[model samples]
Target: MMNWNMTMKRNKLTVLIPPTPDNVNASEWWPVKSDVNWIETVYSDNKPAPSKLQGVDVFIGTDFTYEMAKFADKLKAILIPAAGYERIIADALPNGAVVANASHHEAPIAEWVMMVAVALDHKLLQSHKTFVTGLWDHWPGRYGPYRELFNRTFGIIGFGAIGRRVAKLAKAYDMEVIASGRSNNHSQIAQSLGVKYCWGKQGMKEVLSRSDFLLVATPLIPSTLNLIDEQALASMKKTSYLINPARGNIVNEYALYQALKEKKIAGAAIDTWYKYPTEETDQPRPSTHPFWELDNIIMTPHHSGGTDGTRNRRAQTVAENIDRLTSGQPLINVIDF
Candidate 1:
């Protein structure tokens, strides 16, 4: 292990940033005047050569495969510019190294959640498509009426950062918010936000059955993987809509496709998916299922939290952690496990 006293005296830390969408504008947001030596590099096939990691004091990228960890002899910290750190291989990290992640995505993701909720309830996409084709069937006078978010129940599967933000936003529209988490510990926070909180299987069922609009905001983990299955989907109201901006696999892909296809529920707005492009030029489909053919669903390329504000805030956090490391200070947002 490097001596903190000696490292602080030297006051020169090396930060390696790989070419990632999260780090594309890193230079613009990084501390312009600092002792830190920022080394910008590229990787092929998403794997940097082991030599590139040598002498790197900090790594500011998402993916830390076993291959990269084998050579991160000098790495003191792995700072994930984004909130999700599943790509990081914790078992392979060098001993004494700390892992941390930044999160400024709640605001933007909440905005997207509400936007799509309103769109789904009001059938905005359907109306727009019809009107552009010179069809008046969707006209208020002819199509009867559209739904509003007011007084409707908004259900949340996870009561974390994103869930709390969404609950606050949902209140703005005069919606009743109810949430279920892994435990009852978040009940106090939920109460402060004027949200009804529950936990366990019974709690989840209540949220699912009563919700007019459901939002999935949980992290993907062993317990949460495929948390929403066919049986869970069947519990929802027939008129309810589902919105997911978190990890994709949290909700079973096949079950979601089947529900939408059979009109089991009203509709869905999915921002995350099962498959993604492996290369820059690749245009692989987001899922094995034909979600594009479904008109009731709104599909996005997992960009709900990719706003400029999110990027800048995350970059600032990374820069702060690097500064903390060089100064022998404790890092922020450090993951315990």
Candidate 2:
């Protein structure tokens, strides 16, 4: 059993859960009304207004803008429900306040990456389409050039939680793993996971050239914007596949479209997009480019990490962290302080 230190500060702490749309019932996921103060406030639907942030000790949600930071005078911590907090300005946050984000997204997303990698390598979608078109009987060699994941090289960019999980899954399929990241402290962890640790641009190039399947799982920032541009794509193996489960902006949409359209690489599997629907009913397309017309690419609706298991784990982490904060203990998943 987990020892929950709920005996401290339960009465005085006021947790603020901002209002969301009908599709997202914040109350259903958050803690119900109890002796512990749980305050429900609506702020710009998605973003919390400055006026509403006053006197709040802890803020739970994603959309914390720089403008909102000015009003968070009493804020001690900001807890995000998911792993990505690039939207929140870390430096602008009030002094003494910590920024933390959560994710049980790594496991499910890693599984999805492996599944798509194998599917692309084996030409699963094209083969299935060939059968559907009634050409399998006539064409014996249509799917003859399929590849296997066994003994192949797998490369991962941004060796964080999600990237590390991908390395572990790739190893299970007898793959050689290599990864590049900003920090080199994880060399020991890489060794334990059977991953070759690399750093800097030259190391990134080495991984891209050698990998049969290259995955982009890095956080989106100013430096990572268009990280996989024309030059980077040109360096990859012509037979290799690209798998991006990270933010859409990390890979340039136009460059990716051109690469896949011209067969610069074998194919690509994209779960994130450059554009999204502003309103639920807007139904906007994922990209400006005609990527849907490509036969070699696999496109998903950014649901690689949306499993129930991931949701439960995320909720557990949030609940536990809230308890920890109330108990005057160190918080979990702190990204900035």
Candidate 3:
């Protein structure tokens, strides 16, 4: 039997690639060396054992655990092919191993944010249903008043890559952009993006009170978990809209349902959810609350960042990072542990 703890040199590097979409030939974007050994695996919680993961030098997957990490003695780098790495524990990795995250998701997710914001603002679902059923001409009062995207205040809770992208798009629509973040000082970056930046509790209230459309783009962290609770929801203008393309738990699920049920806020565009399907065949309810029954909100199956452009861009980023790693160049998008 091979000694799992014994570190091995990469005469022929082993690259582990996860299953890609049917149409996407991953080789086109993530090209590898001729001598490299490739390992293919199904992405799931029931992963292969440490013995099976022995010689992995580069792992390109979304999920990793401490149990699996312990066996990766020869691992040089772990590359997350997706934007979010909240679940990844930095301390779990082997000594000297580096981790990097990819983000071509920003552009597509930003577009989704803007699309749903406009759709909800105009009450598109209600209007379309009313129009299709021929209720518009008969009952104009049934459909609520619509709003425009122009000259409105667009607020973002987290000012990361996705938030900045959303800000840029919002600015293109001539909307006033305001952002609040966990960072003590994002003033310069915010100002450069032509957005007013705020921080901490008091600043959050200021942004919430004035925003016409509020977006939650923060990552899931200890401090950010349930960041948008009842108090936060109450602080917002009753006429404002909420758009969440970030993690589901970032907002208090129950409070959001209560707020929407009572019409406290105008409406919301939610692309992320509290619950998700575990398998390809399994269909799970997104929430305990029947958000689907609500007319004021728009719900999507957490697919905001899923686009062909996004996939290709992400693949390119991963490929470039791999090249950078081989050339001993400082890698881009290195996660600050």
In candidate 2, what are the lDDT values of residues 39-104, reduced to their tens digit? 677655356667778888888887677778878888888888888887787777888988888888
Q: Model 3 residue 98 lDDT?
A: 78
List per-prediction Cα lDDT, in the order shown.
Answer: 0.88, 0.83, 0.82
- List the candidate 3 regions with Cα displacement exceeding 4 Å: 1-11, 20-26, 33-35, 45-51, 137-145
Clashing pairs in 3: none
Cα shift from native, residue 165, model 2 (Å): 1.9
lDDT (10s digit) by residue, model 3, range 66-144 = 8888778788887877887876777788888778888889988999999998888776777778779877742446544
Off by over 4 Å in 1: 1-9, 19-27, 44-47
Ranked candidates, highest TM-score first: 1, 3, 2
Candidate 3: deviation at residue 127, Å?
1.2
TM-score, one value per model: 0.93, 0.87, 0.89
- Residue-level lDDT for 29 in candidate 1: 60
Q: On residues 1-337, what C-alpha lDDT tens digit does candidate 1 reach at each position?
A: 4686566558888888775456455456664334677777886545566678989988877778788877898999988888877778779899999999999999999999999999998889999999999999888999989889999999999999999999999999999999998799999989999999999989999999999999999987778889999999999999999999999999999999999999999999999999987666989999999999998999999999999899889888888888788767899999876
